[model samples]
Target: MLALDNIETFRGPAKILHGISMKIEEGEVVAIVGRNGAGKITTMESIIGLLRVKSGQISFRGENITRMSAHSIARRGIGFSPGDCGLFSSLSVQENLEIGRWHADPKRIDKMADGDTLEKRVYSVFPEIEGFKRRNSLKLSGGQRKMVAISRAMYLCPSLLLIDEAFEGLAPVVISRFRDALKKIKEMGITLLMAESNFSNASLVADRVYVLDRGEVLYEGKPKDAMNDPRVKKILQG
Candidate 1:
């Protein structure tokens, strides 16, 4: 549902993505895999319009979004969950989720089935967060904060979700939970574009993997194939 064609992005005076190109089909979980400083997050920011691209084009569901503002792109059914779990420190978990709801396009909400609501969709993937709704966001543990971030993104009722470093720094058990949650999200028909520094972690849920190095695509194919490729192995081992 998303396509980036020979896109180049810059952060300040330095170019971060050098003609990066990739594609995500509807309902697929695609992973941008690379080591630190490999431009995975840059790619995410470019697609979300957080960082404007200097060249090339980005299209979602067949419409060009290269020049759209972040809010406009979001309104077109894209949601982002940043790596740092960008929740308001002073707000309760419930309030953080409510803010996401406020950004939802009313016309999209009206199109949902009679009984479906944004809360239901979010809770479906992260039921644990509901129990701590009244808790201050800053008081939650790391895993809880991550869940809230993803849940808040779900609140946008997006067709495409861009999650940067979904499993970074989490304990193995927490990672497993997120994997299951992501699978549930895919079953619900939402397309996921995840940026992960660890190839193994990305492979756990990604249908297709793109290995990026130095702001360029090094490999693009099935996770299994990438695992066995000698060049990919070299990058993974480091």
Candidate 2:
């Protein structure tokens, strides 16, 4: 239910996304696959309004949000889990989540799962996090940090979730765990848009894949076809 129409954005003095256009249907999992500097995070930032769009439009559920502030966009039902897993190191895991839960607009909760409380939904997606609630965020491992970040975003009760670098450096087993959580998230009716560097890992979870190179879309098709394309292989290989 999110669409980016020929949007161009800049990270700062330099432009990063060049007329990038993509769409995510309701309940769909879409992946933007690219290597470093391919504009994946730029795309996510633009969508979330962390970086303003210089040209074109960004619409969620049919309403334009191109100029909306980051918090405004978030209030409209978009949750972002940044690649760096933005968390307050001094806070306990529960405290971090409490901050998220505090900012949530209760109306954003999915009607289809109205019976489930927001806390229940978050715990369902990540049952493990429930056990680590009292632990300090700085004490957690890399994968645990990622889990906490995603869980914090889920506390927002979003209809569309934007996750950057969801599979960046985790071990295979931990990646598998996240994959299972993603499946459960989609089943719960939340749309997912992920920025991933690993094409094979992204393909396994995404229904559609977009290969971006140098801030432009080089391929937009099935993961299998993208994997076999000479140009895609060339760009991803490097």
Question: Which predicted model would earn the best lDDT?
Answer: 1
CA shift at 117, candidate 2, in angstroms? 1.3
- Candidates' TM-scores? 0.97, 0.96
lDDT of 2 by residue, 1-238 (tens): 8889999998778989999999889999999999899999999999999999999999999999999999988878899999999989999999998877777776665453547876787888888888899999999988889888988888887889999988788998889999998899888788999999999899879999999999999999888889688989998886
Candidate 2: where is the Cα deviation over 4 Å?
110-114
lDDT of each: 0.92, 0.89
Q: Write the per-residue lDDT of candidate 1 for residues 45-128, one digit (tens) a residue.
A: 999999999999999999999999999999888999999999999999999998878998888889878998888888888999
Q: Report the number of clashing residue pairs per model.
A: 1, 0
Evaluate model 1: give its lDDT.
0.92
Best by TM-score: 1
